[model samples]
Target: MKLLLTSAGVNNKSIHNALTDMLGKPIASCNALCIPTAMYGHPWVGPGVNAWEFISGKSENPMVDLGWKSVGVLELTALPSISRDRWVPLVQETDVLLVSGGDALYLNHWMRQSGLAELLPALQAVYVGMSAGSMVMAPNIGEYFASWTPPGGGDEALGLVDFAIFPHLDHELLPDNTMAAAERWAAGMRGPSYAIDDQTAIKVTGGAVEIVSEGNWRHFTP
Candidate 1:
């Protein structure tokens, strides 16, 4: 499996290159399935508003700028009401899975409920995660800015990666995502944890894990 887990989407040349390299092809050749499930629970957006547009600005959506052959939005919350057989094929055909950021627990809940978690491990598509999207790929997410309580009151994440990821350290806008707060949170984690800024990403391909970064990051273990 291959994952390009980022605190923010491809914000710079380094991240863009990292994603392209992981794809093993030109960006224009790939087709992406953008999963905006995490944006569903955002309180900032009122009911009846377009959550994807609110959470993912057109410019910030890397798939659009990367020139993918097609970029389709797959809202995981609507899966239970639809046919899995019909949609599973869309996932199978995509070259990349681009997950947006929001509440980590909410994203995790939907991933399980939508059967996306089970489908992910075997998928040939490269997983591209942004913030909470990246956090949900871990075994668990240590406390940070977002105050999320899982629907089942569970702390477990997808466990796609062995460790927890604490993203957006020292970010400009997110005041709560500070190094002090991250360090404090990481101290309580049961396993290893990584604190990464927006410009950084953790790339994992099978057994190989490497930090592809342009900003500050730190690894913590308890």
Candidate 2:
């Protein structure tokens, strides 16, 4: 399995370079399976247009423009009534799973309810996670926020990887309270944990994990 774990969006040129180096192609060459709706209730949750419009070249999502062929964009809200069978197969078919940033708790809940949790591991696609998408792969979801209330009152994660993933380590961009919450959670974690800055990434391939970037990383174990 290949994992490209990012803190936030691929906004910086340096970060984009690192990502392209890892993927071995320019950003535009890689076919993208974008899941912006996973973060917002719908892709249109942010501005006037929906996620599909943004990804399909109608509008622009800075994150998508950074790289990605924008082959398909899944809107979870419009298809609320549809079964997971209709969606999971689409996710399985992608070459790279580009999970957009969003609320960690809600994303985790939706993934479980939608049956994505069961289907993702079975697929051989490369998983590229940003923010909340990265958090769901960790052992628990509670670490991402200072104080949050899940719709169903649960904070566990999908556990794609054994370690905890701390995203958005840019102190200038994140609130002090949020950073403190993440730090507290990292301090108490039982297994291994990694704190990744916005410019940093943790790449996992062939059972080996490597930090790829010109940024700092801290490892913890309990």
Candidate 3:
């Protein structure tokens, strides 16, 4: 599986290039599915608009600006109302799975409920994750969030990757995103963790992991 887990979306040239390299083709020729399910729970605890802007990538959304032929939103929460067979193929056909950031627990719910988790291993599409999207790929979120938990009382993540990601470290606008907070969070983790700013990403391909950074990032264990 190919995955690009980022604190933010493609925010710099290095990340953009990493994405391009993974695609092995012009990004404009690709088809993208932008999942915004995580954003649904933003108001309860988040930066609101700023989170939206980062997820949306505004009018300059790299997928659009870079030339992805088809880009659309897939609300994972709505999966139950639709035919899974029909929707599952759409995921398989995409060149990219653009998962937006928001509440990790919320997003994890839809991923499991929607069967997206099951489909991921076989997916040829590059999995591009932002913030919460990146976090959900781990074994468990535990109290890394400090203020939240899954509604169903589970800390389990998708376990798509061996480690957890703590995003938005040291971001100026989001006061909670600091190195100190990251240190606290990492200290509680049961396994490896990565603390990354907006311009950083963790790329995993065929079991090899690489840190792609145009900004600050560090790996730690608790």
The candidate that achieves the highest TM-score relative to the unseen native structure: 1
- TM-scores for all candidates: the values are 0.92, 0.77, 0.90
What is the C-alpha lDDT profile of model 1 across 10-62, one tens digit per residue?
Answer: 88788888888999999889988887778766554323344546334463545
Better of 1 and 2 by TM-score: 1
Encode model 3's per-residue lDDT on 62-116: one tens digit a residue. Answer: 5334558888778788898889887988888899988877788888888988888
The CA root-mean-square deviation of candidate 3, after full C-alpha superposition on the true structure, stands at 2.6
List of clashing residue pairs for candidate 1: none
Looking at candidate 2, the ten consecutive residues that score lowest on lDDT are 41-50
Q: Candidate 2 vs candidate 3: which has greater TM-score? A: 3
Model 3 bad stretches (over 4 Å): 44-65, 146-148
Q: Lowest-lDDT window of 10 residues in candidate 3?
A: 56-65
lDDT of 2 by residue, 1-222 (tens): 477777765656665665666667666777767776454642324434554554554433345555466667766554457976787677777667777766666667767666666777777667777767777787675544523456657567777788887776655746652546667868877578888777777777666777766666677676
Q: State in Å the error of residue 52, model 2.
A: 8.2
Model 3, position 93, has a per-residue lDDT of 88
TM-score of candidate 3 to 2 decimals: 0.90
Model 2 global lDDT (CA atoms, 0 to 1): 0.66
